[model samples]
Target: MSTVVAVLGATGGVGQHVCSAFRASGDRVLGIARRPSAAGSALRLDLAEAAPAQLAAALTAHRTEIVVNATGGWVLSAEAMHLAHVQIVERLVAASTLMPDPPRIVHIGTIHEYGPVPAGTLIDESRRPEPQTGYARTKLAGSQALLNATAAGTARGVVLRAVNVCGPGTTSASFLGAVLDRIRDVRPGDRVPMTIADARRDYLDVRDLTDAVVRAARAPESTVGQVINVGRGEAVAMRQLVDWLLAAAGLPPDTIDEQGAAVQSKGGDWTRADNRRAARLLGWQPRTALDASLRDMWHDAARRYSEA
Candidate 1:
């Protein structure tokens, strides 16, 4: 039976892909976002401030059985970020309670919520979260709400704490997205300048992440309410990733701005994902290799650039 899935923040980078993946799998996907999409798929509701009553009405109207929260921790702004990551989750928990058969929520959390581990440590779900930044702290709070509610038997949901995601529909806020912009912006002679903070991060393709999300939505009650870690299972150097991106895109190398590249990033020096729980729990792994992911990202950027 096809599930009725409502994807919150459906217009955002990861959210759009989540909606597409669910739709491609023959699920009835309702795109819920603040703004209407040009494709006419959005439900056009701001989830960050939506009351429990409003959410219940929407769920009832759509007959939603699975809700994929594809929002949170993407934007770095303060008030809105808190609302998106924390407040919206509280509302989602509340709304689920009003349903006779509460919809299963797949809250997409981030690896940043684990903050920085030691240099060579694998970021398993067992590690106690030490979120460093405001964005991550907020995301952790959101995850805590779901965890708490699920434990109390008040909410039916699972949390997929994902890694650094990159793929098609990536925006300028991301590393590869910024690189794509610089690649498209410069003329033949002008060199693109970037402030590179070289750190090893576990990066997952958006498609890969969304695939796990769809699986999570359909997982058995045994798997529901579990916090599964999802990612590529390995960290790659930022510089190495850039090289692969250029190679995969068949683009010429842009000059790396070496003089100012040696700064510590906010997330910290290094961390990779431990995705064993995801495979065990959801029968999922990141099937898309980084090269293929970067290739797709570049090609998608090219298509959009041409359209623009």
Candidate 2:
């Protein structure tokens, strides 16, 4: 009895990995993206622009039991953010109503939606969101939509507000991803220029994050309407992460051009997830060691470089 799952943003950084994980689990997985299908059972339907009827038709066609909203991205514009995070989600809520038995929507939200937490605070599901960035504000709005729908009995879902994600498929759009893009090509003594942000944040392996997504999909109805925090549960210095990456790449600590670094922080920014509820509910916790994550990421980057 395989579950029918549809992953939006199937071709994206995190979405592709989510698709792979679900497929490997022997589920009936449909990879939905705006572009042509490349390697899986993908359907190209831009939910950002599609009507609820359109999305409902696709879900009905696939007999979708779970709809994973992996489509929200890091774009920083009012219209783009609204389309990806708010408008599209509103449509998904409406679309779920149109289903014979509405599917559970596992939305991939951001921990940034918690907005600025105290420098040493651990973020739990109880923190009131005061999202400042356009990305965070829109993502919060999107999560709220699903929550409201779930409360009203019009939808069933879980929102996994994820921390900073790392591991394979790290894109240049992110800080760690930016460093990885340059680290793979650097020799033992070659220098790489980067501006490491002054922040201490929790980082989660993408595979681990996907594992949580799968859990949310399979979780019982009791888990619906819950906003779960998924992460390593500890915030490490951003500069320390860069050091680990360089070490994994077999480069010297001096390989980083520290002169270009952002000004030092005096306990300026931080966030760590209190994953207790997640453990109690989903029986989920990150299993990958941070060092192992960095090492594997380095290997994947080198492998891609070789293939290229």
- Provide the TM-score for each candidate, comma-separated: 0.94, 0.95
Question: Tens-digit lDDT track for model 2 on 1-308?
Answer: 99889998888888988889988999988988888466464788877779999999999988999999998776756898899999989999999999898999999998888888888899999998898778888889999999999999999989999998889877677777778887776777687766777779899999999999999898988999999999999999988999988889888888988755455321236879999999999999999988788888888888888988
Q: How does model 2 fare in lDDT?
A: 0.87
lDDT of 1 by residue, 1-308 (tens): 78899988888888888888888889888888888686435588877668998998898888999998887645767787788889999999999899877889999998888887888889899988998888788988999999899999989889999888887888777777877777665554556567666678889999999899989998898987788999898888887778777765565566444446466444756868898999988899888988889888888888988998
What lDDT is obtained when candidate 1 is compared to the true structure? 0.83
Clashing pairs in model 2?
none
Q: How many backbone clashes does candidate 1 have?
A: 0
CA shift of 215, model 2, Å = 0.8
Q: Which ten residues in a row have the lowest lDDT in candidate 2?
A: 259-268
